[model samples]
Target: MARDRLHEMRGRVAIVGAAESDEVGRLPGKSALMLHAEAAHNALADAGLGAKDVDAVLSTGRQTANDVPEYLGIRPRYLDNTQMGGCSFIAHLQHALCIVEAGVAEVVLITHGESGASRVGMGGGDRFAPDTPPGQFEMPFGIGGPPTRYALAQARHMHEYGTTREQVAEVAVSTRKWAQRNPRALMRDPITVDDVLSSRAIAWPIHLLDCCVVTDGGGALVVTSADRAKDLRRKPVWVLGTGEATCHSIISQMPRFHVWDAAVMAGERAWAMSGAKPSDVDLAMLYDAFTIVPILALEALGFCKPGEGGAFVANGRTAPGGALPMNTNGGGLSYTHTGMYGMFLLVEAVRQLRGECGERQVAGAKTAVCHGTGGILSASATAILSTER
Candidate 1:
């Protein structure tokens, strides 16, 4: 019955508009809320719609749900502030579909913005308070922030599968190759596997080059029923399927150190609903908060078998001219990563399908798989987007 419901939901909603802020890197001047409003306005204009046309609003960041709609001067009939960390926006796509299908709302707007580098308007607070689960358990063990926590998994991946550091470095090298084609990317210079290996080491097996860049940016998406999307300004990028799952909140509690079971569950559900396999994916936008994240995602999402992701990405397979283009926008590794990066993944996927990516465009890309990992592999969301309904 659940399978039938998922099949029925396929292609019922489409993303009509997508946009990022006017500027995406090192914006200490723009407050987090300001970035949100700018991206929201641009997306509405992209859809040839006004703020008044939106009946639903969804956003996640340092701000509250009421704060976003209020600042946008919108009184949405529906509102969602589901905060699942970086993957919140991708999960929002799933919520929007359900809302539209149930006739609860139409023309849903999902937005995200953050001041990761400048820390302009982000209120003062320790992410992991003394009383919090992470503060009590993980942080006390000197496992704070992404690098230290993720190192545990990266080292385990190497121990379990003979995955070499050179193979991991290839991910950074290949992603930078794509960044070289993107004028908007923060890091466009060519890099070799040796460069990544020689870069500063943040944690065991995780080099500085393997980590995502810190920037200030925002991105937004507009979704509506498939019927209404045909009348919008841009070509409707159909939302064929979406799935989200969670495994653990703290890194210590992760079920398996090397594998991302949450991503596996999400990807399986997404593939089942879309009726598309990894073989059918023309492009992929897997989150790259760290190189290992995408490598693990490749295996978890069925792009490659477990323990084979390092090999899958080693030979420029995900580079600009590769057979399967991944992270054409340079990804969080080289592109803008404003704390939460899943929204940008969706924006790039939509633009690639619309043939608006210019030099970085993947020619004849009809199907895209966007997968996001949030909070130390604690949460995962997968979206299957296509040019066809």
Candidate 2:
């Protein structure tokens, strides 16, 4: 895979450093941009570089009005603000690579943070585009927000394939089981499928536990060309391939009962570009915006058949000590969510490939696959990373 990948692409780019700020359910004291700057500085320090070494800045627009770097008091030779919601992290990786390969930047700093739970008084008053089809077609119908929109997808998945509440709960339960081993994970309470099933339902077919936690946290990663990575402290994990795909924004626009085509499309493209197969992945860091998202992504990524995602993870396939370990850092299900789960996905994959994870480490994890979803399953980005030099 490494040989074919390098032969196919430009000079290799490596994820040399990664970092995260303190995570909490809510933090009103520190703003979102502060977290981003902290994570960015730590990431640079991890890479054995100073802010002065950074030549590029790639940031996601925070839920707040100000941009991330504006608060950090730092700028770079390159700047990219690609905002597709959560997938921004993975998409930024692609854009950063282009900047580096084009000699526009030498060191690309990608950062993200969110105080989504702290925005209590300041309402999210109409963040969507006025002409956005989702707002016009769905918002006026008392459709609530992303939680309810995903609930409709869950119901449709259940209707098309005889998936049960326990199957969905299985995802939540399995994630919590893993979270117990992850010290940084937020919700570490021992949980069961019954507990998840019995948790208060946020929307029909979606329990409170099924929905992701609102979190205040930040994540950052430093990307540099392979020539420069050898000078860094840790072993470099090459971003072998990256791909993105998207469906219509609204839940109504997607085909009823058809799970995310974007994930599969991007997954296939990444695999083909990197010359990696499912069997080659030692670990998986799939985005877990909701329990259902990873369940659906597993099937789309060819971990199982279309209708077998629930049964695929049944009897502890995705749980701790399972065949293929997923979200070893607890994931969005249990770990810091910070609005964009995509950064977590990339960070976890790098952690695994670098052999940084302590107890949850997948032994001999030379290669890994990470998939991230943005919006209400509207878009997806897939990446295959390898430890091979």
- Please name the candidate that would achieve the greatest lDDT relative to the true structure: 1
Q: For candidate 2, what is the lDDT? A: 0.80
In angstroms, the error of model 1 at 60 is 0.5
Q: Kindly report which residue stretches of model 2 are placed more than 4 angstroms away from their true locations once superposed.
A: 1-7, 63-66, 120-125, 129-131
lDDT by residue (211-293, candidate 2, tens digit) is 88777877899999888898889788898877788876667787544588888878887777777788888888888878888
Return the TM-score for each candidate structure.
0.98, 0.93
Q: After superposition, how far is residue 281 of candidate 2 from its true place, in Å?
A: 0.9
Candidate 2 clashing pairs? none
How high is the lDDT of residue 33 in model 2? Answer: 70
Error of 1 at 247 (Å): 0.6
lDDT of 1 by residue, 1-389 (tens): 43447768999999998999999999989999899999999999999999989999999887778999999999999999998889999999999999999999989999988888998888766779989998888778787579988888999999999999999888899999888888889998899999999999898789899999999999999999988887887889999989999999888899999999999999998999899999999999999999999999999999999999999997899998888899999999998899899999999999999999888889999999999988989999999999997
